[model samples]
Target: MSLVSAVQVRCPSCNTPFTAQMHRAIDATKEPRLKELLIQGRFNLAQCPQCGVQSALSAPFIYHDASKSLFYCFMPMNMGGSAIQQQQQIGQLTNQFVSSLPPEERKGYMLQPKLYLTMQSLIDDILAADGITKEHIEAIKQRAALLQDIAQSQSVEELERKVKESQDKIDDLFFQTLDDYIAQAQEENDLETAQGLSALRDEISLLTRPEGEIAQQAKQLAAEREEMLDKVINERDQERLRTLISEGRPLMDYSFFLALADRIETAQASGNEIEARRLTKLRDTVLAMIDEQDEAARQSLMQAAEFLRTVIREQNPEQYLRENADRIDDAFFAVLNANIIEAQRRKDENAMKALAAIGTVAASILEEKAPPEVRLLNRVMRTEPEQRRALLQEERALLDDRFVALVDQMISQLPEENADLAGELRQLRDMAIDVRAQG
Candidate 1:
């Protein structure tokens, strides 16, 4: 009997090398189908001995100078019409399956199966370029066929079975081919190719290892994104509150009360029951101020109102503080009295005494011999329209200059950087000069 020379190839899975014997002559009677299948590049599950990964290898039927051969020639003219016919048949079947899905679902459905097939095709392309042995090629073909079956299966059970079978075949083919390729490399002294193939096998093995670092990075990114979103939400809420205050929303003008409510709501939302309860008590204190009808209590409420107005105007300078300037002036004077009361409550004796002295001096002057201009100025300064027109000519004359002087003093006392107040005071001074000229 003649000795059969074995064909060897490298295994992709375990980096082992193995060999399979090449048949010298086709056994037409004993296994006719086997001969045909070998020519057509078809095989069943063949696993790697090292890792049990499945694979398939089959040689393509070719003709060389009127003699049947297992390998195809490089020249296009040497290729038989039968090879082209088989390729076309496979393409048609693939197209038919893809076209069967609905338009909307088609892309997603095809994508999943296509990914597996694409990976397998990449492996085949790499092996084919390396000029792997017939046994390795046949093993790859069997693995590809099994992967195709897995992709096409609709039911989970069918898919699982196909996957297991394909894995088994892949193991057998990869281990056997790897063993043969390593042996061949040693024999031929191709150290570089051996190292490269070994690295590829090692990379495949790493796929089963836990990707803890990757998972941790993903979680960190997610948390950062969530924190950024929360910050944006809080900024939006504060902007809404500012807008409401600037718009002179009636309920929002009570800053102490509104702030209390805001704190309570925020605390509750954050699940801080203790903080929410404390804020609720603060809200009740503000409500009590509004409930009292006495002059002292009303003055306290007015100070809170003026403080709210100041806050709104300062925060949103572009917004108009008052539609009616005269009404605003009267309101300002009324709120001053409230400020004194608030200052007294806080034991601000200096502020209260200073305001009281000013009030006393003004009252004393009213009792003295008043000029017409001074009286008229006093009338104009009054909060009520009836009081303004009740002024005698002599009283108007006497009070006008004093009123201008008072306004100048108040303007000088304001913060130097208060541009809005400075501008308004300048206009008031001009108006006073115009009134004096008319007198």
Candidate 2:
């Protein structure tokens, strides 16, 4: 676990004083996600509740990756201190990290940590250790610059010409890089920049991909969805409708309700009074069903949260997790992740470690029980893009229609807020389909 503590910081936008959590040390082996957040420049970032302003707190921190034998300390130059004072701060951080480890785990390398004056330089070295060299990063930057030029095109002809000229540069990594920029902008509360980047991403996606292919596919999917919804809404059999509602619960989102309302309006506009009345009744029934489902989900999450608290109190969650394996469902994991995020928000190192341990155990259990195709899909999702093809090749037997359908199901079940994940799943789904077809 990392060392976390409370600190007071005033928001740059609103100048509102608020307590922010800061991490002084990070053990990459124990908390890999923290390392990722660090690389993304999101580490120790604080967001103001008053104005939604986000700023990274400039503080001294240590990073350690045991597997890589990589240890580095970061001390911001902005924090004015004498050379001796900086050394003392770094020494204290190093001591804390080394003392937290077991005697056997402590090595000579742990005693001497490399120091960095800036976070960006530290992040670059970290990426280099992960095999992402400076050239690769520079290439991504060039693509970003090209994307900016494309976005600033004076006319449709210029945009098209620029895109065609830089077709070689506009690869999957291009969109990914742009998405990173959008995420950074959004985090900093620069909505205009974020929105612009998003629009540019969409435009680039349309230009680089098969023309009208995505739109056509989306249209077909929507039509099929509409037909299914119509069938469910028009079904007069109470028993059949109940079964349909239960099965189609995932599709009963705000959009689904809005579509139903539109149908009711259309019926009224067409002077179909009886049909309108019937549609209204169906809408009411569906709304009630959704409310009931929401309540059940809320209750389930509450129970899961309480169960996690109990496990944390026990301090030995292995037994509890094993005994209550059946209860360690998606809801439980969702609660677990939420708890970890909240702990991260408050910089509660102990809570984060405990929740992470529980999550690891629960995930292993689930993986053990999952089908081979599911296991392969999980690995594919976790693997880097360039390496996934080889992984799929090794597990080609699992790349069947069933796996593709499973991916589709996941994509469909994801909430609208998880657009990024859904997009990734869609790409994975396409890749799996391609692999299966390669047979």
Candidate 3:
């Protein structure tokens, strides 16, 4: 079963309200296509019909790969809460995920899921599990950053200087990144940026006509790009085409489109007008999809910014938060966290304190909304390590079946790495059982 829900969103651009479907959990084994989206960094993406803007919601979700015995609970670090509160939230999500599984398939690893504080780290580990090395991933990241720097050069001279200085760093990944962005720019009708990137590519190609190992990798990348283009050309299903565009986004660059246009021309010259028309239609559809994704990315960022502005402008941010608590979701926290980090970078103490206050309030609200048992568990966990026993004893009246069951479930699934927490949960469960026996 797909774990998705309809979320109401107000477009930051047009202020038009709409419903967006978001997935709460991903079972990659069942939905391999979704796994592709996650890998392509397009999962949980939403587009506004009103303004045609796409937004990537930074929502909390669980990822399970039964094949690899991988289970991860990703709670955005920006969700702002104490360690105890965060654990309680994670516990709830973990329990829900476990309950969703069939009894036979449910394993001990499912219960003690690995916790990821950030989406990128989670993605990196997922790739690592798939045999992608950290060093390779880091190199790709550096190349991407370098590409951005080259693109942002204020003048031709500056761009040329940067290109020459970073010639050694440029490789297949760098060209792939450049090609991807150029394709995006063309899709969005930013001809200037597209042309600029094309010119930069020409210069880089001349400087490093790669040979041997580098040349072999470049040839492989080109072949993969051609394969992706063929998939788009032959796909008959609209949905599948969309998926292809998303999964092969990196390959859908200037060269891919050029190759596609060449095919269309060849079909037309060969008097295969029907084939030519079909290819043209495919091109149009791809362009539209790219535009929608670009808009979504823009709008999502704008929504986060607008939400932050609203919170910061209010005299009573907490009260505002209380009234509009639904808006303080993962995406909101992501934006807030980024701002807090930027403020810290700038050494703006006041801004950090203000942002931190909002986080504290958000945590408090989350704790307040938790089930009574969960709230009690949070309190117990929050109590001083040495004094928790006394606290639990004093509040023994609260130790009912629900509390005992929760404790037991936690103890059963607790990872060996978390020996301290496992011991604490065991103590709680034992004391709760003893209290019930006495009655």
Candidate 4:
């Protein structure tokens, strides 16, 4: 069960008081989405409605994973509770959690809960349980640190010096780390940093080119280019040829241009001047098409960003959210996220903050405006077990037998592999019945 309760909390930004849902216990076997959010570091994220301030809610939380048999209690070091008191609280919480599970489901591991001094340690352990070693994670972190250092370098001499010292570490992981930083910088609206990292990426790519494979690889590439073009033009394989224009299909690869150049040569060699001219014209058209597409995408992203900026810059952003409730979804978030990164790259702090605020405000409105069924279901899931009976009875008008039957039918349709959902549905049905009885 997910142990959560509503709380009155003041926004850190504008000191605005608001009602927010706070989770005490997250169960992987019950509310899987919470578990996913936890892994994504988005669990307990709250946004202030008045000021649009978004931040993670730092508090004690019990994280339970049945499959991994990992039941850990995370107590934020800032809590400042006595060790003995914290231990007692953990013991009591552990007892309550174990009792909530069926006897058959309760394992010996529940007898003693593992205590993490910090949230980071808890996250590290969770990743470790999934077979990701701490060393590998650390190495990736080092790469990220180095990437930032390179991006923040004052001059090419400094960058070159640093590269000389850490050249061996500039592998795939290093570039990936650099890319991640670029995205992060964009999200924060740090433009200068993004551009700097991008430049560093290109510099590294050039510096790290294989010292001796160029000539041989060039010949190999030329052969591949001619062969592919032979299939596309001579064999007239339209399907194969169409791949060149496909999005993210490496349209900018040197071999792709080589293939077009080859087509021109072949046409001229065959003494077909018209055909040679046509191929040359086609290459120009393809280049133009690529440029046009790139420019169009950039404009679209900027447009979306500007719209978000307008919404956030408003005195009452909630009005905008209410107006465009349907548009504030995953795709919208994605566009906003990309623009945020771009904003950060541009060193646009105001835009970054505005983007963040827009997300928080939009999310709050969307949640508040969710369908009655979704709202009721979430309430039922987050409510205390003891209070659930009364809640169901109170909401019995909406949660009629038809609703229970629908959920019951939903459970029946699940495959045997989805045993967790089946158990959760059963629990929901029983709770609804119990609540209906209270009425």
TM-scores for candidates 1 onward, in order = 0.17, 0.54, 0.39, 0.40
> Any idea what lDDT model 4 has?
0.73
Which runs in model 3 stand beyond 4 Å of their true positions?
Answer: 12-14, 30-42, 50-56, 78-105, 152-161, 176-203, 210-439
Give the distance in Å from residue 424's predicted Cα in candidate 3 to where it truly belongs: 76
**Mind giving the per-residue lDDT tens digits that candidate 1 earns over 178-233?**
44444334223344454444544443333222468546744664565444333322
Instruction: Give the winner by TM-score: 2 or 4.
Output: 2
Cα lDDT tens digits, model 3, 58-131, are 66788998889999988887888899998898787777777887888788887788888888899998989989
lDDT score at residue 23, model 3, on the 0-100 scale: 88
Q: What TM-score does prediction 2 earn?
A: 0.54
TM-score of 4: 0.40
Point to the candidate with the largest lDDT: 2
The candidate that achieves the highest TM-score relative to the unseen native structure:
2
lDDT-wise, the better of 1 and 4 is 4
Better of 2 and 3 by TM-score: 2
